[model samples]
Target: MFMKTFGWSFAISAVALIVAFIYGGLEALILCAILGVLEVSLSFDNAVVNARILERMSAFWQKMFLTVGILIAVVGMRVAFPLLIVGVTANLNPVEAIRLAMEKGSIDDPGSYAYLLHEAHPQIAAFGGIFLLMLFLDFMFEERELRWLGLLERPLAFVGRLNGASLVIGLLVLVASATMVRPGKEIDVLISGILGLVTYFLVRGLGDLFDVDNDGDTDADDAGALAKSATRGVGKAVGKAAFMLFLYLEVIDASFSFDGVIGAFAITSDPIIIALGLGLIGAIFVRSLTVYLVREGTLDDYEYLDHGAHWAIGALALILLLTISVEINEIITGLIGVLFIGSAFISSIVRNKRVTAASLPSVDQLSS
Candidate 1:
């Protein structure tokens, strides 16, 4: 399964090696390889969340995620998206910005592409952070039988009794971050955060609007509720539902990738190297990871895994919002995610063993 899943990754890596050698040198190839591994490590939570979302989608859309969605991840979000942000923030045209990013690959200099991305970091962080906060918030508030961290999840669900509670929390985070961030960055962070909040609502709104409820239940008073409550209907409508889900997942992917692009700069800032190394190879691996999880029904077996991923996401969101005022290592963020999800996975295995033992017949019954 590993080889089958990551077959393209090998090819992409080989190509990245050649590309790096041609573009920069053997040094660049080494940096590209490290960036790819760093990306996979940093974004494992993304794979978990993606598996959850992908489970709801149709088989065709699942394939699309492996194919078309990956294309978007490598080409659109990870590569072009970073350039677009730099372009907009630097007041350069897209072409000019791409040129600047490709032409400048220095990591130590403050005037480099990576540094310029840092200049835009707060806004990038704000945008991704808010979108991710909404995702994390929704998961926390979602009513499900599975509970990974009951201590926190249960209380959160209790507070979730209030309508718009999650939305309120999201707004509060935005406001708090604005105040807490440095004065020079306060306005930019807030504006970007607000835009991120609006983008979340818009995506959820579109999903609810387009994912038609065939059951004739028109009671969608709470948009947040509708976001998860409205499960996809059957047969022909499945295609539409899956397509909407694809859009939803892509947005989620986009939210998960901002820090990745910037963090890759910490290794090297050659735009093509970043695009091919981190973007392509890492993206293919992630998609494969998502597919593997769903195919194996890992989520069904490990009930609390999604919960852990959400906790990690919540942590990442806070880090992004706080990055404006604090220096956070990408390694720390990745570790948080790894610890949360890894603990949950172990917990799930233990729980499964307990349940299996409880269901087994006693010696007395066997004798009878």
Candidate 2:
């Protein structure tokens, strides 16, 4: 079972090693491998959260996730997205940005392509942070029977019943970030954060409005109706629910990639290196992890795992917001996610054992 699930992961690793060896011999190989590990460590929480979404999707959409979705993850995000950032921020053409990326790494000049990306970091962080913060906040604020953090989550859920509660919190956090960051960068951060929040509301609101579920509360299970509700005309040609789910999954993946993209720079300033090392290979592993979890019913078995991922996402969001003024270590970010997920797994096991023990008949009762 393990081999079937993880066989492709091993193949990817072997391919990466060979690629690294061909490119720059042992040094590049080791660095590439480390970068891959770093990406997986920082993104395990992402896989957990993705499993929740993927489980709800149809098998066809799920297959699309592994196929079409992997292409988006590798090419669209790993290669193109970084160039887009550089183009927009530095006023360079997208093609020019690509040329610069392939030139020879950012070695000679302090004002290279890599440096421009660094300059754009605050705005990037604000956008990604706000988007992810909304995801975390929205999840927590929603009423759920099963909660891992009862003390805080219950109150948040109660408050969530109020209209626009998540927006209020997101705005407050952005406002706080504005105060902390330098005056010159403050407006950029604020605008980015606002856009991020709006984007979340726009996407999430549409999905919720047209969401098809087994709960029986919704009746828009019809493709025609769902398309009308979601995008007016966007989903008419495609399976409406499936199309919406595809977009939702992409947005979720983008939010996760923001940190990975920016953090990859910390390892190497070369865009191609970042793309090859941290970007493509890590994405493969994460997508595989999501599939494995969904297929194995890992979330059902480990009840609190989803809650833990949400909490870890919230922590990451807070850190990114704070990073506008403060520099945080990559190692610390990765460790925080690991701690949350690990703790939750253990808690689930302990709870399951207790429940099993309680259900068993005592020897005295049997004797009686």
Candidate 3:
């Protein structure tokens, strides 16, 4: 099953390596491999969190995610996104932007690629940080007793019924906060925060609305009705859920890519190198890591892993927000996630041993 899911990953990576060899020569290949490893390591927690949502998706959607989704990630974000950002922000023509990004060793020259990246850093940080903070707060403060908007509870029950309205309110709050606290870049911050919130709520709502209930809750088992609710009588809720899941996945991917995209500026501003190095490496691992999480049932086995990842994501978001006034290293953000995930893994192993030991019969009784 794992092989079936991840077989394409190996093929793709191999192809990428071959292309790198031909186009970029040996140096490019070596750099791509190293960057791939670094991206994979930094993004393991992201893969784990993504797995929780992806595993719940139907097989067809999963395939779409791997194929079409990968194209969007590698081509759209790694290549086009940066260029677009440059064009929009710097008022540079696309051709000139591409030219500036491609001059070999240009990235290291002062006031060249680095200056451009630094200029845009505030906006990138604003978007990534606020979006991540919202996700973190939602996960950390999520009410356990109530599922999906905490409907079982009173205050939350009212809040849950607001459906899409809560998202609007969240946006308003974000806007208000940005305006009050950071007046200089308030507009940029608001735009980033709203985009993140809207994306998350839409995706998560679709997931919740379409989710199948297998735990035997009769009220929750109305799959047909659940599937039908999201569309304005156009499609099944499951379809909507799948679409939402796709959106959710995209947002997550975008958030994960933000640091790498920005950091790639620090490497060599060759758009080709940035695209090939980060895209091939990061894309391959996302697929592999997603499969690993699904196969291992990591979410089910390690109760705290999701929490840890969410916390890490939240911390990253916070760091991004702080970047408005202060710089936060990507390495630090990555290490925080590693530490949290490592602690969760150790805790899971210890818990598993305790459970196994409890289930075992006493040695004296066995001897008798």
Provide the overall lDDT of each model, using Cα atoms, as 2-decimal numbers.
0.80, 0.81, 0.68
**What digit string (tens of lDDT, one per residue) describes model 1 on residues 1-368?**
87877787788778877888787788888888887887888788999999888766555567788889988999998778878878887788888887888776576667666778878888888889999999888878878787878888899988888899878998898888888776788889889998998989888887788763232323233343334434423222245656777888999898888878877777777788788777877877788888888777688788878888889999999888888767788888889889988998999999999999999999999999
Query: For residues 256-287, could you state the per-residue lDDT of candidate 3 as single tens digits?
Result: 87887887666556667667778976777787
Ranking by lDDT: 2, 1, 3
Candidate 2 pairs with clashing backbones: none
Q: What is the lDDT of residue 236 in candidate 3?
A: 23
- Please list the Cα RMSD from the true structure of every candidate, rounded to 1 decimal place: 5.4, 5.5, 7.0
The total number of steric clashes, by the backbone 3 Å criterion, in model 3 comes to: 1
Model 2, 1-368: lDDT tens digits are 67787788779878877887788788777778877888899888899999887766656677898999988988898888888988998789978898877664553366577777777889988998999999998899888888887999999999999998988989999999989998799899999999998888888777766663322232334453344335322222125666676788888888888777877777776665676677667888898899899778798899999999999999989988888888898778889999999999999999899989999999999999
lDDT of 1: 0.80
Q: Estimate the TM-score of every prediction.
A: 0.90, 0.90, 0.77
With a 3 Å backbone cut-off (N, CA, C), the pairs that clash in candidate 3 are 227-237
Query: Which has the higher lDDT value, candidate number 2 or candidate number 3?
Result: 2
Q: Which residue pairs clash in candidate 1? A: none
Give the winner by lDDT: 2
